[model samples]
Target chain A: MKQQSKARAHTNIALIKYWGKRDNKLFLPMNSSLSLTLDAFYSETSVELSDSFEADSFILNDQPQNSQETAKISHFLDLFRQTAGIKTAAKVVSQNFVPTAAGLASSASAFAALGAAMNHATGLNLDLAELSTYVRRGSGSATRSVYGGFVEWQMGTTSADSLAVEIDDASWDIGMITVAVNTNKKTLSSRDGMKLTVETSAFYPAWLESAAKDLVSIKEAIHKQDFQQLGEITESNGMKMHGTMLGATPPFSYWEALTVEVLTKIREIRRQGWQCYFTMDAGPNVKILCRYSDAEAIQKLLTTAFPDNPVIISKVGSGVKLI
Target chain B: MKQQSKARAHTNIALIKYWGKRDNKLFLPMNSSLSLTLDAFYSETSVELSDSFEADSFILNDQPQNSQETAKISHFLDLFRQTAGIKTAAKVVSQNFVPTAAGLASSASAFAALGAAMNHATGLNLDLAELSTYVRRGSGSATRSVYGGFVEWQMGTTSADSLAVEIDDASWDIGMITVAVNTNKKTLSSRDGMKLTVETSAFYPAWLESAAKDLVSIKEAIHKQDFQQLGEITESNGMKMHGTMLGATPPFSYWEALTVEVLTKIREIRRQGWQCYFTMDAGPNVKILCRYSDAEAIQKLLTTAFPDNPVIISKVGSGVKLI
Candidate 1:
């Protein structure tokens, strides 16, 4: 086996949104979700393919990987190896570029970069669709990291077709300001929350049924370069995801004091006629999607409102590539 | 002024379930729910002509009614007067005969009987449908008490047709055993819970879409006397309702220790091949629906299992009527 090269990848935030899954094992979703890859926040990973080890090894930010953390990674590697007809093991060394404890999409960058690096090492020369399928097996949202600018993870019937595809290059006026509310990991993981929604929530079907329509509308809105349409749909989708969590049998909430604060500030800013909108994942941290020109003013207002917490601003970024 | 006559009423438990309101003023539901009215538990009431006050007065179980509790009843009485073309107001005296903290359908009986007796006193000669419509304006479930034995409150688009109608007389081998858990009023009222579900739950539409199918299946199961089918569907429906509560924005739970205990015991009993099924309402108490012959055995087991608490058993009961 040839010595593997090291690489880095940045995380992306969903603009349309992906919530529930079609297949848990493969991390296949029921509907497509579009996202914008940012240049600033990312994860740096080094993958070395070796024959000495029996199984794959993962080290995140210089820490040794535990069984739980490596489970999804191991599965992804196994799929890639089986597809390539290779029996050798691999070692993954990864570091998140985002601030420690920051509730950001670090996994997106990690899996996306890992998928790209692993493919390069094996010389599979897999297409973007094939690479996305591998990454999705690791994390549902990771598929979006296969491309930079504007990307959409098309939720096809099977994992084979459910790969990330680039939409617009996003070389336009769009920018994102990530307000780091809390650096700590969230109480509810999106994977678990989505599973619970699928298993117990009576409202899961409604989300599944309407998601395609939402995606279509969001795509049209994005094409028109309308911030209001994008913001409204994004906010609605976020609410819908949270709604499913609330409907679980035991009921789980992905909200904190900071979540409320962020929402309040976002609404206040919006009421002031700012072209800024906020979207959150499974954590309290919020990423405001707005025009490049409005990003500075919005960031200023947010910093003033939350004097203690610092917000990170970045322009739309590119997808996985050789560094 | 004439002396008030003593009368009693019983509340019915809706099996099909009612949700969503078309008209807040009329308290009309979007769909009909089926319910059973029990005979052993009821609410007794009496009314008298009073010229000493400008408005009607109410006393519940020897306690003076507060303005908040009287508002709905007062409004209903006003509507009744307008519908019947009555001239004067009357004083209402009510007493509930059902065990107060047993989570029994006391309010159903109380309101149904009140509506019936009030109608009798008014010399309106209104049928059960008219009575149900009048009472439903006060409490949605109260409309089901106008008929006996598997009554369904048809959620007609109009109030005139949205009345409770009898489906079966329940003269078959059916019996119900209610295991008293905690009799305390729920912290989250159904009205508030429903409102929360409507406003916040992302899965609400999904539940709404599938409810009709569930109602149909349960109705068929009941007609076929398939205990397994009935039990399964009933449990699913109950779980769905509870799931919606959990999915509320803030999320709330209804399961108590006793709820768990009763469910455990029911599962244990079911293991022994007794065709017993459990159903619960807004409270922690559980009502077990089973064959008439198994009632005594079920009662004995429940009593022995829960020695600290009282377990009451009752056969299929009749609807509201004059003695």
Candidate 2:
């Protein structure tokens, strides 16, 4: 009756990372990437449109947002309005369980939820693929969050072709453990970082060149349910991403002492015969991939090593859906 | 009457790093590399060749070496004996002002000194070039340390052709600052790490393919005395080297928390318009390269940032020499 809709979308971790953008205007990736949505972190958003509203209003995490923060959402909403051919203003409320811009892929869930809520509220009736194309306009990773479990973001030539595809529901025994380290905003933003690496890093060319090969090999690994091969490739992909950062002109990194200690300990754990692997985004936190049977043990080991930090274990999650 | 010959060799930091081994037996590098010898870290060795000795004995840092370490020296001594046509047990006494096995390039100085001392003590009459070839048999980087300032190691087809040559004395205003983060022995030896990276890293091929190009470019920069080009390539080479480790099967790193902080601060310093850059070895420490004019200011900043760690400043140094 209130012309309102609510939706939730889970976040994801890239097993094969997307580092450089070929087209910043459309957020077109230079390489295809693979990711796994997690059950532990998600975003919920509700949108209401009516003739009674004076102007568009936005709220996040139970707080009113300033124009600067709301500007991005407002711009994204304009696209939905243009499609629906409606002048009515809307009120948007979003809440996130994931840390904002902390490299936990929060925007992936946030915009995925936003896209779903808009679809319901405006009665756009866009399917998942069409919806993914729109969702990616907000955040590149959000496209993958439109689908459940394993997904792949194809580095297509156009926006329509560049949508994500569901790879597997991950019915397998795979799991992930996250080490949430220093929550402080990154000193370097991903936008600036990607640009810096593309423009200045000597290895950026190599990163771009090898990404396709990596995607193909990793997809095969995922298909064969080869946990060792998958884990090894995923770990190497993350390191390659960080390596590009180090080769950036001014050179930057998101790793902390805790990150290195955890990495070293994880290597030791692997030597001890655990099939665990690690990946990191543009933040100091590290996400480890392992078998569900080993998740509890890995979490326990990490908890013991980093007693002061938070260790969260998560399983594969479903796609964005409306409630 | 001591019948001893003393030689001193200064350590060198690689601008174009030597990462992989093509022939492990002869310590042949997969790629040619360039380096700068520094005055701050050097090793001195006194070799006494006498028939009075029952067997070859070695002393390092004023302590008698264990059989394991002494075996390496004994093997190296066999080369000198082969060249001089004599078999004599030698008492090798060595001292280091540099941190051993901690990425400060200590082996470069240690082995270079050993080679020079053996040449003098045994009357091998090996020229500097021949001595460098002998030094490289112990450690690949030792070849570069045999020459002063700007030096290049040729990754040749065989041991006879693979040798180090001096490029320049670097009499210009260049200087290096070392932040010795930790003095502990690394858990993974360089030999093992190189082997693992070679066998496992997906990016190793790229690193090997790019080294010759980097060597040529850095040489041009060195000849022109272009600080920015030299510094940029040096920084990128280190990142590429570290990148191979990340792609290794079990994956490891030498970075710690302090390493990231220092890297970030260094970036901030660069943004403020300083002609300074950074490179790292196989440990948690960092080396900053800058003009001699800015060395003091850079050292002051680092000293203030890391009061607990030792900050050493060094200028271009001479090649290995007998006293």
Top lDDT hit:
2
lDDT of 1 by residue, A1-323 (tens): 75585666778998767887877777888778999889888877777888877778889889998988787677777777887899788888888897764568677888888888888777776887789888887777889988888888998887689988778877668899988877766556778877787887667777666567768888888788777887777776666666666445544556555665677688779889987777778776788888887889998999898887878888888878866
lDDT of 2 by residue, B1-323 (tens): 23589999999999899998999999989999999999888999999999899888999998999999999999999999998888888999999978642347578899999999989998877888878889999889999999998999988888887899999999999999888777687788888998998987666787787667789999999999999999988887887788777766656677777787777677668788887888888888899889878888988888898888777788889999897
Clashing pairs in 2: A257-B257
Once fitted onto the true fold, the runs of candidate 1 whose alpha carbons sit more than 4 angstroms away are A4-27, A33-117, A123-130, A138-205, A209-323, B1-4, B50-55, B67-71, B79-84, B98-100, B103-105, B171-188, B195-206, B243-315
Candidate 2 residue B314 C-alpha distance from true site, Å:
2.8
Model 2 bad stretches (over 4 Å):
A1-3, A51-55, A63-71, A78-89, A99-103, A208-210, A224-226, A268-275, A291-301, B1-4, B48-55, B62-68, B84-91, B99-105, B265-276, B291-301
Distance from true location, Cα of B203 in model 2, Å: 2.3
TM-score of every candidate relative to the true structure = 0.64, 0.89
Look at candidate 2 and tell me the lDDT of residue A321: 92
User: Model 1 over residues B1-323: C-alpha lDDT tens digits?
Assistant: 44355556666655555656667678887565777667667887776655555777889889989988777677767766677676467788888878865577566777887887777777665888878888888788888877877787888878798898777877777777788887777777777767777776655666676567777887787788676776666655665665555445544445565666777688679889888877677667788877778899988998899987768777777777765
